[model samples]
Every structure is written in structure tokens, then in C-alpha cells.
Target: MAPTLRLLAAELARRCDQDGPHADGTGTGGVAEMERAALLPPGKLLRPLLFTESAAATGMRRADTLAAALGVERLHVGSLVHDDVIDGDTQRRGRPSVVARYGLPNAIVTGDALLIGAFREVAAHTPASVPDARRLAVVQTLAEAGVDLCRGQAMEDELRAQGDRDVDRYLRMISLKTGALFRASCLGGAQLAGAPAAAQHALTRYAEHLGRAFQMADDLLPHTSDTATSGKSALSDLRNARPTFPVLLCWHRTNEQGRAQLSALLAGTLPAETAMETLRVLLRESGALTQARAAARAEAAQAKAALDELPATEARAALHAVADLAVDRDR
Candidate 1:
């Protein structure tokens, strides 16, 4: 991470530790605080990094920009907390997940607390130079992103239940689930910098494509990386029977025998470990892994192209690097 981003991440972590309501009724020093703190620990901080970098690209690095960045990070962390619960994941970043440590109900409340803290952080700390109307716009952006995020999560659940294989539908769902916040992060920074509408639109597109690339790469991690490398169980997605990009692509490209094997695995007819091993083989043999990687690389290229519309600067160069990072990250 760059020095500025590292500083911003540290500040955001401090804020998360200090601002939220305690999980325990005592309001301090309890399991709730511990859970909240655990969730906010240093990680990629990708959303906030995007926000700060976007703001910098617009030649704006005001206090409000940092505040917006922090807000986005909080929202991202909250989503992860809830995602672990929904996926029944017991591990995150190589540690026991909040759901695993505190149980589901507490984890739910912990996520909600972080979300509420995100709004409060935005409302209280947006730069003083920003006018009231612009600040309100930033708040509205966060609110809409949150709504779309929930809708996407629900859509994912429905798709999983129905075992939908339409790649386009999956793309749209991920755009909502993952891309919405990325869009919001970029928009918040641009808005904070008071960039014109054209620039904001460009950054939004950059974020959208970059987000898709990030998620697609992430979807491949279970097949390509181990638990130690990826920081979560490799079988988590398979265990939940989630129809990830690789799985769907493999299904579409493979022979009937391969499809039947995948179906049996997803239907829980095969042992979990054996099923995952078979699915991995099927994906590799069908060229689905290669295709999925190509898709991610294509999205990253689109993201970089979008940066061309922005004013040329070192920040823009950094954003270009971010696009590469999205697809190339190992974890």
C-alpha cells in the first residue's frame, strides 16, 4: 500500500474501534467490541483505497475525502461480516469469522453496528469545505449502494436455490452485489473533489469494471488457491453449492458426462472433498478456468481504458495499477 492509503486505513481502523455501539450492553470492553474490532483489522481496504485514489485523481484530497473513504471501508467490512453468516463460513482472512466466534445473531448485530457506524462516520466527518447539498449527495450514494447490495445478496440466494446457470444473470447479480459499492466508492471520492459529471461518470465505469474483475478473480481462488493462500476454506463455495462464474462456465462448456458429474456434486450425492476435487478437474479440463481468467483480464482492460477519459496524472496512473491489481491479486 502507498503511504497515504496506509495512513487512511489506519485512521479508518481507529474510527471503527471507537465509534460503534458495543455488542454488549455495557457499551465498552465486551464481545461486541471485540467482534467489531476483529472485523475492522487491517486488510486490503480496497474500497477506501479506490475512494482516496479517485479523489486524488480529481486533485482533491480534503478531509472529507478521507471520511468518505473510511465510510466505504466500514460498509465493505460490514458486508463481509454478513456474507460470512450467509455463506455459513467459519473462517475469514485465515481466522475464525465473526459468525464462528460470536454466533450468528451476534454477528448479525455486529454487521448492523458497523453499517450504522458507516453512515455516522460520513455524516459527522465529511469535509467542512463541502456544501450541504454535496454532502447529502454522498450520503444518498451510500444509501442506494446499501440497498442494491442487499437486493443482490437476496438475488444470489434465489439463484443458488434454483441452481441458475445463466452467465448473464450471474454477471448482473455480481454487478449489484460487488460493483455497487465500488461504484459508490469512486463516486464518493469524485463528488467530494467536486469533479464534474463527466469525470464522475468515467470513474464510476472504472470502478464497475474493476469490481467485476476483482470478483471473478476471487471466484477462481477456491479452485486455484488453498485455504492458507486465500484465507478461507477452499470448499466454502462448493459446500454452499454456489454457482460461481467458473462453475457456470464449466457447466456450459463441458460434455454431458462432465455436467452430470458436476450435478451430482452440487446435489450432494458425492463426498464433499471428493466433489471439490472432481469439480476442480472438470473446470480445468473444460477450459472454464482459462475462460474465466480471460474474462477477468478483459474487465481489467476495460477499467484501465476508462481511466483514459480522466485527467492525466500520477493518480490516474495509480488507478491504472489498481485495475491490474484487481485481477492479479492472489487473495
Candidate 2:
């Protein structure tokens, strides 16, 4: 890890501890406690790190940025908890999922607590002691982004349920579900620093492209890696009947026989091993992995271009490193 990134992650992790509420009074206190512990592991911590690095690059003090960064990450973690429940997933980060460990109701409540707490943190720290309007604007932007994410997720669910196979539809789903948060993270960092509009907008573009690349990489990991490495079931997406970028690409490129194989996998009833094998075959035969890598390269190039507006500095370099890592990361 970069020195700056390590420092930022440590600071945000500390803030999360300080800002995150104890579960004792909540209905799902036990689950909340587990969630708390889960946050400190050696996972990517990508969103908070990105937010902090972006802010630092634009002259935001580490102290000034921590609360917002932590808040965003908390919101992200909350969403993942809720997502696991919705998808009926039983594991995350290689352990039993919140719902599996503490039942769905408690998991839901824990997620709600995180979201509410995130908003509160943003409200308390922004505006920088000026007129409160700017602070409110940040909150509003973040709130709307979260809502858009839910809408995007709903759209994806609907499409998959209806057996939609179009690549455009999948892109729309990823843009909203994944890209919104990325945009919000970048914008939030810039807003907190009172950065110029050009810098803010530049980071926004960088984040948007990086976000899509990140999701594409995430979507590709299952077929290329094992469950132990990915920290979740390798076949989970397949079992959930979700159509990822690679799968969508293969579906679009394959001939009739290959399409039939993919359709059989999508019947919402394949065994885990069979689904994994089908995905492997599709990726290999259709060259979907190659295409996915090329797409990621294009996005990474766009991300790098967006950084041209920022002053040359270690922090800017860190941001670029993150963009590169997003496309090349194994998990």
C-alpha cells in the first residue's frame, strides 16, 4: 500500500470506530457488533481510501476528510450487508454473512443503522462552519446517489428476472448500482475540501470510469479465481442468476450452440459446479476475458486523462495507482 493510502485507511478506520454506534441498544446489537469487527480486516477498503486520497490531493486536511470518508464507507458496508440478505448469500469476506449469522431482520436493522449514521456524520462535519447550505447540498447529493443505487439494483433484478440479455441493459445496471457511489465518493472528497469545480469534475470523471472498471473486474473474478481468494462463493453470481459483463459479452458474441449453453446456465437452476464450468467455457471460447480486459484498459485510460487537471503530486500519483489497481486487482 502507498504510505498516504495506509495513513488514510488507518485514520478512516479509527473514525469508523468512533462514529459507528454500539449495538447494545439496537434490536440487532449482536449482529451490529459482528459487523463492527468485520470492518477492520485486510480487504480493499477502496471507497474510503479513494475519498481520502482524492481529498488530500486537493488540499483537504486528513482530519477534515476522515469523517466524510468513514461515513461513505459505512454506507457502502451497510449496502453490502443488505445485499447479502437480499441475495440470500450466506458468506462475506470468507465468513458467515450478517443474515446467516444473525437472521434477516437483524441484518436489515443493522444496515439501516449504518445508513442513518452515515447521513448524520455528513451533516455534522460538512459546511466548514460557513452557511449550512453547502453542507446540506452534499447530504442531498449523497442521499440521491444512494437512492439511485437502489433504483439501479432494482432495475438489474427486474432485467435478470425477465431474462433480459442485452449488453446496454447491463451497463445501465452497473452505472447506477456501482458508478453512483464512485461519483459520490469523488465529489464528496472535493466538496469537503472546498475544491474548485474543475478539480471536482475531473475527479468525478476519473471515479466514474474507475467504478465501471472495478465492477467489470469484480464480475470477472469468479470465473478466474477460487472462493477462498475472492472471500465469497465463486459461483454466487451464477447461482443468483445475475448476468455480469463477461457473461453478457459472451452471450452477445457466442454462436447458437454457445448461446444455448449459456441459456441453460441461466435457467436459475444450475448446480454450482456446472454453472462454474459453463462460465469458464463461455469466457474461454468467446474470448470474453480478453474483451473485458480491453474494456478495462479503455476505462483506465479515461481515468488517467481525468487526472491531468490535478497538480502533479504524490497524492495525484496515488489516485492514478488506484485506477491502475482497479483494473488489475485480483479480487
Q: Which candidate is the best by lDDT?
A: 1
What TM-score, over all chains together, does every model reach? 0.95, 0.92
Query: What is the per-residue lDDT of model 2 for residues 300-330, given as tens digits with 9 covering 90 to 100?
Result: 8899889999999777888898888888866
- Return the lDDT, model 1, position 73: 79
- Candidate 2 — which residues are off by over 4 angstroms? 12-34, 125-131
- Residue pair clashes in candidate 2: none
What lDDT is obtained when candidate 1 is compared to the true structure?
Answer: 0.85
Tens digit of lDDT per residue, candidate 1, span 1-331?
4866777867866765664454455666554475456555667878888888888889886344787788787788888899998889998898888889888888888888778777876788886777877777878999999999999999898898998989999999999999999999998888878889999999999999998999999999988888898898988888888879999999999999998998888888888899999998999999999999999999999999999989888778888988998888779
Best candidate according to TM-score: 1
11: Cα error in model 2, Å: 3.6
